[model samples]
Target: MAINPDAVGTTGTPVESSWTSKDSLLYAVGIGAGTTDLAFTTENSMNIAQRAYPTQAVVLGDASGAFANIGTFNPAMLVHGEQAITLHRELPVQGSVVTTGEVTAVWDKGKGAVVEVTSRSVAPDGEPMFDKVMSVFIRGEGGFGGERGPSGSRSMPHEGSTPDLEVTLTTREDQALTYRLSGDRNPLHSDPSFAALAGFDRPILHGLCTYGFTGRALLQGLCEGDPARFRSMEGRFSSPVFPGESLTVRMWRDGAGAARFSTHGGDGRVVLDAGRVTFDPA
Candidate 1:
C-alpha cells in the first residue's frame, strides 16, 4: 500500500525506555568519544562524573512505532532525510522516559515521499525531557498527488567570512559496528552483502552516527562541553558517510546563542547540511 497522507496526527502508544551508565558510555564511544572525553566515556574517573551526550536522547526512546499508521512501504528504501532535537534539560547518565510518537506530516516529491514524525519524552516526574523530529524519504512511494510541502531556507555561512569554529574528527573503520550496539542493528551498517544489495560499495555508517559526531563538536565548541547549554540542533543528511571517513564541522556564529553549521566528509562532500543550532546564552 502507498503512504497515508491522512495519517498525520496519528499517535502511538507511550513507550517506556530506560538506559544505564554503561549504555551512555558505549554510546559516547560509538560516536567517537575517547579518553579525552572521560566525562562521557567513563563512569568513574578521578573527580570526573559521567555525563550523557545530548544527542543520546535520539536512541533513548522508540518512536518508529508511529510509522505503522503512515501506511506500508519498502523499509529498505527509506532513508533518513533530516533530524532535529530539542532538549528541555540535561540528560542524566542513566534514566527512564515515557515517550509518545506521532505522525506529523507527509510530503509527496514526485518520485518519492517524505514522512515526518515527532516524538516527545517525559521523565517519570512528568517533566518534559526532550523532543525529536525525524524525516525519512521513501523511494517509489509518491505520485499520489499530495502537497509538496514547504521548502525550507538554507542557513549558509556569510560570503568572504571564515567560520567562527571548525573541528575535525575521524571515525574508526569499525565505527558502525560499535554504533550498532546502541539499538540500531540494521544490516546495511554491518553486513557487507546486505550493503551491496542496498547499492553501497560496503556497509555505510549510519547517518545518525555521523549526526552524533557533529553533535559532539557542537557540544564542545558552542556549549563549553556542558549538555545543559545545548538547546536544539537540526540538520539534513545530504550524502552517505563511510565508517572510517573523517568529518570536518564548520560553524558560523549567528549572534549569541545561535549558529549555522555544516559537516563535510573527507572528500569535501557535504554529508550534513543546513545545520542550525541554538544554545542557552552564557
Candidate 2:
C-alpha cells in the first residue's frame, strides 16, 4: 500500500466525545505520573484545580482511525515523526469536545511520504480549545510526484545556556501496554512480531507516550506540579525509546513562563528534541 496523493486535502468526519475526571486521571497514570503529580493523578485535586494535563489533549485530538479512509499506506511502515500543539485555552478536567481533522500536506521525502494532519478541537459550547499537527512518515510510500520535503517544519534553535531544570523518569517494561489504555492501541507500540516485521528489534514506546513524560518533566520541574500552569508543548521525535530506559529532560527557561527543552536517554541518545513549552504567565 502507498500514499494516495489525491487524499491530501481529505477531511475526516467530526468526532464528538466527552471525558471525565477518571479518564483524565487514567491518562496521567498511563504517562507514568506518580503520587506526587496529584493534579493529574487525583480527581479531588483536579476538582480543585479544574485543569487537565496539556498533553491530555493528544488523546482527545487523536484521529488515528480517521486516516484509514484517506491513505493506502501500510500501517507497519508508518512512523510518528513530529508533533505540535497550540493551546488557545485551558482544558477543563471533564467536558464534551469535538475534533475535526484534515490532511494538510503530503510532502515526499526520499525514503517515504511525510503526511501532515491538522486537527481542530473545540468545546461543546464551540469554544476553540487547541490546534494539533501530527506529522507521520510512511516508508516505501514516497516518490508520488508530490513536493520534495516538509515545509514550515523547522527545528527549534538550541538552548545554549545551562539548563535551569532537569527531570529523569524511567519507563517500566510494560509501559506500552499500560499506555495503550489511553486510546492509542497501535501494534507498533506492542506486538513483538509486528514490531520485528516493521524493522524494530522490539516494540518501541509511542511517541506521544514519550511526549507525556516530557510534559510531566516540565510540570514537575517548572510548574510546581500544577497542571494549570502548563499551556502548550511541542517536540520532534528524534529516536525511538525502548521501554525500561530512562529519559532525562533538560529545560532552559526562556523567560518566566516559557522554556526550550530536549530529552535524551541514559544512553545519551536524543529521544525528543527541539522541544518547547509554555505556561500561564506568572
Candidate 3:
C-alpha cells in the first residue's frame, strides 16, 4: 500500500490557535533569553531580543479533535522530528492573535511515517504575522500498506547504554504565564476550564517551550553558550509538564559533536523522551 500525499494533507481537520506577547518573551526565557547577570533582572527582560537574526516562534497546537485514527496508532510512538518558524514582525508585549494550522504534507520512509503541519499566525488586524512548519515522525508506523516516499530520517545513536548527564530545573508556579508572554496563548495553557475540556487536568506548558529550554540547557553545557556552534535540536513531548516543578534533563553525548537528550519530572517520571540534538565545534 502507498500513502497519498494529497489525502494526508487533507485528512485532518483545520484548527485555529491564538497567541500573545507574553507568550513570546516567556518562550525566549525558556530558550535562555537573559544574558549573563542581566538575564534575570527586570531591565533585561523588558527588552525584546534573540540569540541570532532569526527569531522565529513555534507552538504546540494539538488537533486531537480532527485526528484521523485516534485510537489505532499509538501517540507514544510519535516523535517531533523537524521544526521551522518565520517571524513577520516583533511580537507585542500582550494581545490576542490566531494561528490557523493545517496538515501540510506526509511522507513515508519505510521505517516510519512523517507528518508535517503548516501554521499561519495572523494578528486581529488580519495581517499575517508569521508562518511555521512542524513535523513528527512515528517510528514503526510504516508498512501499514502505505507507499514509501522521500524523507529525512535521524540516524540512531551507537549501540550501547551510556552514562548520561542530567540537569534539573524547577519552574515557578506562574511559569506558564511568564512563558506565554514570550508569544503563545493557546488558552489551553492559561485557562483551566479550557484545558480540562482539552483533556488536561490543568493548564500545561507549551511543547516548544520545553524544547527551547532543552536547547538552552544543551547550549549551556555543550556549546558553552555559543549559538553559532549549535547546528540543530529536536525532540518529542511524551507527556505534559505542569508549572511549578523540577524538570530533570538527561544528556547522552555521542561524541564531541552530536548528542541525545531527554527530561524527567522531579518525581523521576519521564516528561520528554527520544530527544536528539546536534552541535559543532566553535
Top-TM-score candidate index: 1
Kindly give the stretch of ten consecutive residues in candidate 2 with the minimal lDDT sum.
150-159
lDDT of each: 0.93, 0.82, 0.60
* Model 3 misplaced stretches (Cα beyond 4 Å): 1-4, 7-26, 30-104, 107-114, 118-133, 136-164
| Each prediction's RMSD to truth | 1.2, 2.6, 7.9
Mark the regions of model 2 whose C-alpha exceeds 4 Å error after superposition. Answer: 44-51, 62-69, 151-156, 159-161
Which of candidates 2 and 3 is the stronger one according to lDDT? 2
Q: Candidates ranked by TM-score, best first? A: 1, 2, 3
Please report the candidate that would top lDDT against the real structure. 1
Clashes of each: 0, 0, 20
Model 3: per-residue Cα lDDT over 1-282, one tens digit each? 233445454434434555444454455565445545233212335573333312324543334432352224566466666555555554343444565566666666678777776666677677866566667777776655555655343333632455367666667667787667655667877899988986888898866666666666776777776555666555656677787767777788877787887777778776666666666765
- The TM-scores of all predictions, comma-separated, are 0.97, 0.89, 0.58
lDDT of 2 by residue, 201-230 (tens): 999998899999898888888888776677
lDDT digits (tens) for residues 1-282 of candidate 1? 699999999999999989999999999999999989999999889899899999998888889789989999989889899999999999999999999999999999988999999999999898999999999999999999999997855657663478899999999999999999998999999999999998989999999999999999999899989998999999999999999899999999999999999999999999999999999877
